[model samples]
Target: MTEPRFHGPDFAALEASDPEIAGIVLDELDRQRGGLQLIASENLTSPAGLAAQGSVLTNKYAEGYPGARYYGGCEVVDRAETIAIERAKALFGADHVNVQPHSGASANLAVYAAFAQPGDSVLAMSLPHGGHLTHGATVNFSGRWFTAVPYHVRKDTELIDYDEVRELALVHRPRIIVAGATAYSRELDFAAFRAIADEVGAILWVDAAHFIGLVAGKAIPSPVPYADVVSATTHKVLRGPRGGMLMCRAEHARAVDKAVFPFGQGGPMMHTIAAKAVAFGEAQTESYARYAAQVVANARTLSTSLVDAGMRAVSGGTDTHLILFDLQHLRIDGRTAEARCAAAGITLNKNAIPFDPAPPAVASGIRVGSAAVTTQGFDAEDMNAVGSLVARAVRAEAGTADGDRELAAVKDEVTTLVARKPAYPVI
Candidate 1:
């Protein structure tokens, strides 16, 4: 076969080759800049980071660790990957770092591969009660392949019950215990988890996908000292390319690396790794620390405003970038609230609050996040206004003239608010 030819890195070239895909890309960018993005799992990657993701490194096929790659001509990609790993280690104070897995779920899969055998008992938070699917929801691979034992929060406090965790650990004696959440708003007691894991002789794995950025910015406590291994996604509040990473103790470093490559995945995405490195460097700055602090402050203010407007915060309020709001008292459901917010130019997701009566599809609560908005330069006062807008939209009745007017007004205000700080101002 003849040597293949590749095009240069330019939007003009893409438009020239395939304007349809280019138009879709531009439209997505427009959509992002046009409205409020409140999804807890999303954030805008910086222009520099985006450039790295779109770099020529995408052509490389580095199938193994940096220096021991299976493919030839991996020298440049090796440098990028090494930089990513070192930067990540510094950012999280980790003993070893693997910048390979394609997503957070992928990283979790690797974690299982590294530490546990199929059918080994694993303990984690329950999915409907703020845990991630990989933490052992029945439908996920983790739950299907392993015996899953779950723990839940207290009904009154809506916080993780350490006593229950200890009881479960003593009974099940799982091979691994995961400590993390996707929808939880309060800080996790890593020390508590560590103690429980030690008692049970279980490996402590912390999925820091959602809050690792906060940890990197020093906005909250780090799980590095407590956890045997930690999994994270470079996106979310980390504001990098969409990919996964693993950090583990030096003793488990070899196992983690082998698990990510050959066992869990092949050829790493060198370009995304480069982008993660760029984001890691950015996260080390003072401005990013300030940004992380503002993210938490904004979420707290927004949660208080929602409570003032008659909605209830799941854990009273947030100490991080995310908040879970219960709409039960308003006699509304999460699905309806999600639709209303979307119609009013705001975007968020329906989520199940702890002990929610409604099913997952029509959840009793909605999950909101401040990372994207805070990155767009929203302060606490701006968050308060956003909270009012969200409340007005969600509380408005549908199929009524009065409700239509209310939603329209909120939509107008939302348009005005987002205009003040565009998601991608340079674009």
Candidate 2:
């Protein structure tokens, strides 16, 4: 609360002798807490999840899966992990679930290790066109270890072309087909993907990391029905800790479990697993469903507002929690917009629009989402203003020297708005 005190009493005393480094860390935390977090891949967890994450469970070493441990004092950790896995399986209707992958990418790696060998062909969505890095970007380990073939969306529509995906799958005949993405703005046709995987006898791995909460709330069709393997992060829309989980059919449970344990990783972080269970329990409520629905509504509202302001929103609008705005078309690069917004205390990420001409450092797009803002109780009206502020700033950034002054005013207004809506309330 107090700028996330980087040093405790003792450490503070030690650093008090020379407060420069400690002062810098404190300033950084103040900056983070002061800014509005609009990054789609991020979320603040519930108090219960936070409690579990910082609990005594961190003391134990649970080397193997539940019911099998390499050390003592893991009985409680086993229960925690079991509850997490069971709740997740029930939530997604999966035959098996593993709550130990350190991250979503690791979960994907475990699936690959379970189902295929090194250098095996794997099909995934293209990075620039809305695929995750783990789904075989050139710089990622997936592309290095496996033959990663990527498919993209239609250029004009900026939506996934099922026909193109099928054509690529058929031509590639991959060992595994990965569905889902990091920055796409439309609902995925999991059944269509299932059919393509079926035709090639390839396993379907769905990375529901970005939309697990919406899927759990039934706001979007759950990918579990069509996917052979599912990997997701505990945070994002899931509103849990920063970790990943994996689920699969019972037939592949042992293989997947082994791959995650001795093969992919060892000694699970029990505290994170405990946090996952807590968040999963929270995801089962009726209120969460309504929250999920509002997420979509807010996205649509925000996207519509931006488009009306003369910004091009890819695919016309969104069916999920994110909206990708092509800033290049507005004569503003994403990098400049991101800096300008950050100076105004708005914290969103710059991204590449599908098949963008710009480089990663200076992207052609800016992705805005409403999850964190919605958590702060901002509704459609707030999104409209937020959208307008964003659009104006980006446009002004192109040629005006007064963008900095205007952004500073926006930052003061945002801080005043945030002061009225507290993230945590007295329960």
Candidate 3:
């Protein structure tokens, strides 16, 4: 009989030590390989990046910035952090970069720590109008601590109203004017935002968590030049680890660094920092630029295809990787649509459309994204087919035999499609 292999750095060893957890890991791999991932804020990180995240650096606890550590034995981790900061600075064209924040929300918290007091006013897009919760939802710390001033998209246009934003800024004179969104599908006018912020003497902080990856790839206009500070995620379109990063102008460098280190968080996650460095290096490649361009193209194609399949594309269509679909025409709620898509081997999420009639729990919109599929080597034509499949899935009436047949058919077709270009193609 073969001896139990309880050793390091191998799946066999993990299986021998803990079969239950190992089986779960393998099952998740199988699920990812077998299905379509269309979550707007999600992406498939490279194996190299994953290796860095799973590296021995995880054992080290680097508590401060490079070269200035609270922990004694952080010399090696410091080097990894310095590399990450330099690469992020180069990628985003910012004078300062902090790769310490654990998530985009953490990065935003650091920004608030750096720039404003608890009672200061914060002007950001309203959550129901395509903004992130960190922007100032009532339940979030941002809204609870600060005087939250919300803005909205135009009723007819279904797009951000610059005039309204300017008006709000002028009236509120918020300490920080946030310019970014979580679900909005249009490119932001960072220059316009800068002008507004300057007019009101408010700090222009862009929450680029959803679209920073495209900026890194040079596929979209960067807010780095216009905003006073930009907080972003290393994942999503950026295709790094599940981490947060902040970039800012030179004037705020010290404040930003202090905010990330001693204020917002305690110790730096050195392994994730190293993984972010790997991702930033990869983003500098020409292939990444091409991938970014394809992402937008696929999104536009997918939105158009969904429109053809009787869904109303919010804002007439998308100019970015995300597409928000209003499902009022079909009379199906976003929750139901999300479940239907999942049953058909496609994954997406329920979202609220601008001025949605239904509550958030049963929102009126479904959000789709192209970044993951594009990373999986899917193209415009593939997105078109995906749109058709999504439409069929959403229209199927669950709990009925006809709906079951339709779901089975869609699942079979999805299985065939994903097989052609499986995620993590090697294994």
Candidate 4:
């Protein structure tokens, strides 16, 4: 007699059991399929990643590291996590890897916890000038616990001023200097940052959450060799599940692991770890390298097109997967542009530009990325058309009949284009 095969939960059964949630899920699926997703931080996960995230491993409670789990029945989860660790190490060429942080913020926090005590000084990029909230934003834990000295981009060039960074680091003498950004479009000078850290006797922590995939594919430079610790989210350009990872030099491995486990979070999400393993494996492929290259090319194309259509790409143009453009030239606020573009079926986030006069709520700029669209099979040509649609939508007057007509026309075109390129054809 053969052993019985196990099957997963049926969505039809779920629909019958919880129709409201099921309907909402279906609606969201429809929404994703219908519109463009230009959010710089968002990406569509692979079908294999989706399956791993929804796997039975979610039921497991592996409280400790793989080999020394506090709970029972973790033999398989141990293997999954170990695979994730090894794959990440191979991909990034790190001395050690931690695949358990729940989000990128958590990863950064753990790094901070490992390196600095309360009241220690941290030098990082300012939030309004393209840095992430975890990187010493005033309201965040890093700022609340540690003394945060933020660096800024130059007003004239709208780019990070390494001279100023060195000046600040010398004055503050911070314990850690975080080098990375959330909305910055230019390639960071990681080697310069490392030198500053060395000069200041500070730990160089790089938050590569936005560009890890590019680094992995060699489309951009890696921070692993230059930084003491590097943190990243698996979701962004990595195109994995919504989780975080930390890679570090061998000396910090034990401290980093302790911080992530008993200090930062409880039991690890084994399901997400499984998903991360799948994504890391996928990133190792030749196709992913091509995809990463295309993501940058598409961003450059979109930036040029936006400039041609009357917007200014921040720092002139992009060197990675994102573009930050100011809307002040068009006499438009980021809020109004975001709303109008949403109406026209183009999705993106309002962002604060360098030296932005406008407040964060109604920022002076919009941030666009090529990761999601590239995942959906968009090329440079498609990006040009996307830039045109974005320009037309944002240029429309709000709450007017003419504006409504223009938005409708753009929405129809977006719908037709998006229909031709579905986000998840395997699904």
Kindly list the per-residue Cα lDDT of model 2 for residues 1-427, writing each as its tens digit.
Answer: 4686443234466477868887885676465457677898887788788778977788899999777788888888889998998898878888999999999888888988999988999999999888988888879889898999988899879888889889988898999998899999789999999999999999999989999889988899998878888998988988899999988888889999999989989888999999999988888889888888888888899899889999889888899999998876677888988888877788888999888999989999999887777766778887888787777666655335686678777888777666666465432
The residue pairs that clash in candidate 3, if any, are: 213-238
* Model number with the top TM-score: 4
Clashing pairs in 2: none
Local distance difference test, per candidate? Answer: 0.93, 0.85, 0.93, 0.93
**lDDT score at residue 47, model 3, on the 0-100 scale:** 93
What digit string (tens of lDDT, one per residue) describes model 3 on residues 314-374? Answer: 8999888999999998999999999999999999999999999999999999999999999
Question: What value of lDDT does candidate 1 attain over all alpha carbons?
Answer: 0.93
Per-candidate TM vs. native?
Answer: 0.97, 0.92, 0.98, 0.98
Error of 1 at 135 (Å): 1.0
Query: What TM-score does candidate 2 reach?
Result: 0.92
lDDT of 2: 0.85
Clashes of 1: 0
lDDT of 1 by residue, 318-395 (tens): 999999999998999999999988888899999999999999999999999999999999998899899999999998
Segments of candidate 4 deviating more than 4 angstroms: 1-4
Q: Write the per-residue lDDT of candidate 4 for residues 1-427, one digit (tens) a residue.
A: 9876967766798799999999998888888888999998999999899989988999999999988989999999999999999999999999999999999989998998899999999999999999988887778887789888989999889899999999999999999999999999999999999999999899999999999999988899899999999999999999999999999999999999999999999999999999999999999999999999999999999999999999999999999999999989888999999999999998999999988999999999999999999999998789889999999999988689999999999999999999999888756
